[model samples]
Target: MKKIYSIPVFLTMMFLVACSEDFLDLKPIAMETEETFYKDFDALDMTATAAYGILCTRDIFDYYIFMGYASAADDVEVGGENTNDWPQFQAVDRLQHSPMLSTIFDSWGYCYKGIRMTNEFLSRVDKIRATDTKVNQALVDQRIAEMKFLRAFYHFYLAVVYGGVPIADKIVDPSMFSTPRNSLKEVYDFMIKDLKEAIPYLKEKSQLAPNYGRVSKGAARALLAKILLYESSYAKNYPGDERFAGMQERWTEALQYAEEVINSGEYQLVGINGERFASWRNPNGGVGGYRWIFTLDGDNSPESIWEIQNVMDGKGWTYTRGSYIVTYFTVRYYYRPSDPTHSDRVVGGWSFNLPTSYMVNAFGNQDSRETGLHSVPVDPKLDPRFATSIGRPGDTILVNDQTEGEKWFPMSFSNLPTQTISRKYECSPQEYWNGRTNDNEGPMNVRWIRYADVVLMAAEAAYMAGDKPKALNYINQIRKRARMSGNTGYPEDLTDISFEDIVHERRL
Candidate 1:
């Protein structure tokens, strides 16, 4: 009887204890706890890496949201099977997007999501450094600098797209989730400060290993230059606009930073005068100075200041690490029954972000250009970038299969109303084969910032600062490269480049 009573007593105590809050308070053994995770250098670095993953995800840098951003420009039009397709993009294209828009919210939420990760990592780093002496201080410093750059990058884009966003430099408490937006000046000032502080600790492009897509000092300076240029342009364009008052003075600083990037000796143009980098990944080992910049071969080249790294593994639709955005831009095609393999031709795509006629005509008149074996009717007098940038109705597009070699066919798509496709970002056959899971995945790295873009920004800054000669010099550099890329004698350099010329060159 005593034994039975003791059993019941034990069972009751066990139940009560198990129900108590402290019962499950034990540290997680099989998993990681926040307290235990930041004790080492590698763990903190991994956290920084995870923060960078936000850039690779659909929430921040993927197709749907980016297409929405692109549609705002006249150069690109959102095309699909019909008007009902991808209404989010259509709303933005038509400038009818409201606060209820999902893409805007996604950008906002995911940007803050990235900021939260960086803030937490930074805060935890400080705490661990105070208490733990085993940490690698040097690596920690570099990682901290990287986080600052990334955080500022997010803020810069937000300010540009949706003026005066909230700046989150530290982890926010749940009670303070409704923080008010900062002024545009305040946001820009914060980004400038963070990037300047980070530049010293960040590595140069040359310091990083080949194909290392990490944030470098040149990227930081380039971004700083861009931010200042935008602010200066806004203020100059709208002098009475109080939001950008005094920003006109930033042109000198912008030019300084941009020139710094130009003179850094860490980057240069690839395929200058039709030269090819050994890194060029042409399936047939062909050469096109500017065209290869978008292919897998041109990734992480010296000309690329910053690129969003992507890989072609067998990742499915759920994965965002691959260049899924290319699929949207690629031309949609049907495999004919006679050529069921789609042998040597380009693969199919959903055909979004079709270039408008205004954009195509911007390149100038077309002429018959001579090929090695034949004469193809392309705009020889037009800007050489036309051949590399756009695949028109008469042009042949790339879809090289290694087994069958290179095959060229006329650009034909079933769903394209515009009857043209952007060739700059089409997925190569090599990338398609590598992404065995589906066409949705490709290995093309998104060239977010290139040396050419930096030079152009510098030109704008110089022009805004009342230095026309410097601006002309920069513009001429791009023209020279373009001439060489297409091996054309046309699109001659302007004797005196105007501000309009700078803008027009940028459109190309």
Candidate 2:
């Protein structure tokens, strides 16, 4: 017991007397201080990287959640032998709210999380001062503006889904937990304000060389047009009501912004002729040969005003197996284990979403854009898109042997006598699955926002504003591009025709 007596007591006293600094010096093994992240250029880049990282999350485009739900709003069908659970989607298509309403709630949360991260980047980047002036201040401002635009975008998605949401412009402390939902008008105002503020600071088309997908003035204008259109539409619901007196004004603004993009000549719609579809189908073309357009890769395609870059191969949390596209779109041909050509590599087993009979019929039994964009034929006499958009069950499709050949497979319903045709977008053969190969992921690029949609939105706005001729002109442009016969139906020409017909034509 000699001298060991007070050892424990002596050590405890020493630890207490050593001062708080010594204890603080112990430091966390892995914890990082907020200041550490804002120390330099690399740190600022990391912030931007974090903002972009949100796109990889499951709720966004990476999964079929957004597209699946949004498409459900239209006449797109739900059930098939290979299709997944479609109760919520079916309810939405019917305009009936169901228990699946939670799906939209989930989307709301995911989108806000993205906005929060983007907000953080915008708020923190100013604290960083780089050594190089050219790449420091101006670049930082541009990045911050880009993040702001992205934040606005995330909010826009939420607004569309839920009509209202809490706008968080920064990472708030836990003390500020309770917040109420803003009105749809309030949110739209905020979105427009952000875009307007960002336009001046945003990089021009020439400044963004390698990073073409980043937000540009044109992108901001495009989004503004969409916002105005939605606002005007909401206003029109209450006609002759002074409640939304500025509806027409907003529509005029939308038209003006769209005109700006058109006059800028910076972007062009992808021409859809004989080789156009095939060109888009090619993997090597990058953005389907449309530079400045958004695609799966970061490559800047002309059509992509602002796009998120998706990598099939990456490490850490960003790593994607690249099976999402195939799994969601591929038909039974790609998922069946017994098929001779089946590679056994692709994990697709269920068809998550399928076009509805109404949507198919909306194409008016022709090769319209709606059909050509998604379906392939199960019956040769039917639309070829049914075969082009969806895949076939057999190795051979009647006489067609080429990859581009008609591979449509039929879908039967108990209530319906005729088999509904499947589209090529939903079709995939097992032989095409390449496991880890990038090619098997299918087309990675998804247009989160596109000029085509903007055009259609303008057309809708024009129609709502009582400019029937203008509406028809815009609608005809889209129809001509799709090679579908133009609509001769006008309000006066066909008073009995429902507005649903207009929406249907737009969908095509």
Candidate 3:
């Protein structure tokens, strides 16, 4: 009887111990604990994917809000406004800040959100087990580097637009909601540090598939070069400020980085010529021609360093469809005289930001860039880019749907006298409203960074560093590529030339 009692006691104890162990194992799989998610590679990849999604947001591209507003606000381009709705943007000439500036502010918010996500990923990944079999530690490192580069890029954009902004490294906790702005110098310091740290770990440009236009070594260098140029210029223009004291040093550094990209030989300029423009008449010829660079399908072009991808057929369309706002704003009914019945359809009657006579006169006498990218008078005396860029009155080209007898189509903008204004940056009439139709040409892919910008930045840096010959060499390369005639404005007597000339060249 004693033996039987001992057995029962043993069984009860064993059952109680098992129950305790089960209670201790109550961790949930669906809601990943910090140890399970951060301690692995799969979770990190998911975070990276999430960060990339931010690039597709409407505020970044899909329309003229970001690039159009910012660039147009400067002297590089102008827009026509027929109405008072977007009055603030029209007031760019007066240097008035308006609601349109919010587009940039929105970009800042999105960029920070992306940065916070990236930081979260980086912080957690660092703590992950080194011995973990599933994680490729190198990839994690590279991704972290990419994230840092992206963060720097975001800050750079902010600095350029607002001159200064608060710098956030880690994800801000809910309790810390408010922060003061940092000086431009402080912001740039942080940006440079981030880019420098990332450069070593980033992959070469060649390794990236066309789809992965994400941050790479070349892009990082390009951005650094651009930042340095801007800093140098700021210092030169506004002296006596300690913030810009190291401008020359930064300019030298900018040249070094830009040269790295140039030597890498990873990018090539797209060849644009009369044949390229004539091919626009072929619908199937879109991708094969340079015009494709203007549309969503060209997001993955080799020339694209970074571009915002837009899709019109999606459920949550980030880009607006219909007549592009640019077309409605810039193109007048008189511009397309072929449709005589619609000659009175002056959609956007008000010319908001008219190109100053000064700007129009500034175009180089033989510069094709101006004529190719804007619409001017039909007179052969004017620049070619004028016709290409903007639709002028009494101009005709072969329409896509032309029949044999009507070998060519005629488009006249005689009534639309202001057709001489810049239109390359603006959307076309059909593109303004209905994005789904082929008639609309406004839903274009926005090229955030490109080779031309990189080249110009390098030239500016070289000039600032007192390397006039090198600067002129770089500038001439771009000029020649753009089909401009004559010697690059870089004068033989560097003493007479001013940095202002270089800046003006860049603006043009």
Candidate whose lDDT is highest: 1
In model 3, state the lDDT of residue 475: 68
Query: For candidate 1, what is the TM-score?
Result: 0.86
lDDT of 2 by residue, 27-140 (tens): 565878876546676677776776766666544555445345755564445443433355555465556755357555666666776787787776666555534344557777
Residue 208 shift from truth in candidate 1, angstroms: 1.2
**Residue 334 of model 2: what lDDT?**
30
- Tell me the tens digit of each residue's lDDT in model 3 across 1-508: 9998999899999988778666878889689676676656776678876666666565553344533464354333344434244555445434665544755466677778877877777677666636458777677778888888878877876676677778888878877677888888888888889888888888876787654546778888888788777777777787887655544446888889888887777775554321342233345533222344444444455556665444444334443322233443344433233455634433332333344334454443233334322222223224333333444444444322222232233443443334454444443324343233433334555577777678777777887788877877776565444443111222112223345556545554
User: Against the hidden true structure, what lDDT does model 1 obtain?
Assistant: 0.75
* Ten-residue stretch with the least lDDT total in model 2: 484-493
TM-score of every candidate: 0.86, 0.71, 0.74
Angstrom error at residue 128, model 3: 3.9
- TM-score, cand. 2: 0.71
lDDT of 3: 0.57
TM-score of 3: 0.74
Flag the better candidate by TM-score, 1 or 2: 1
* Alpha-carbon runs more than 4 Å astray in model 1: 1-31, 64-66, 245-248, 277-285, 312-319, 334-346, 365-381, 398-406, 433-435
Runs of candidate 3 exceeding 4 Å displacement: 1-39, 61-68, 71-81, 91-93, 98-101, 129-131, 242-249, 272-278, 281-302, 310-356, 365-385, 396-417, 421-444, 484-501
Better of 1 and 3 by TM-score: 1
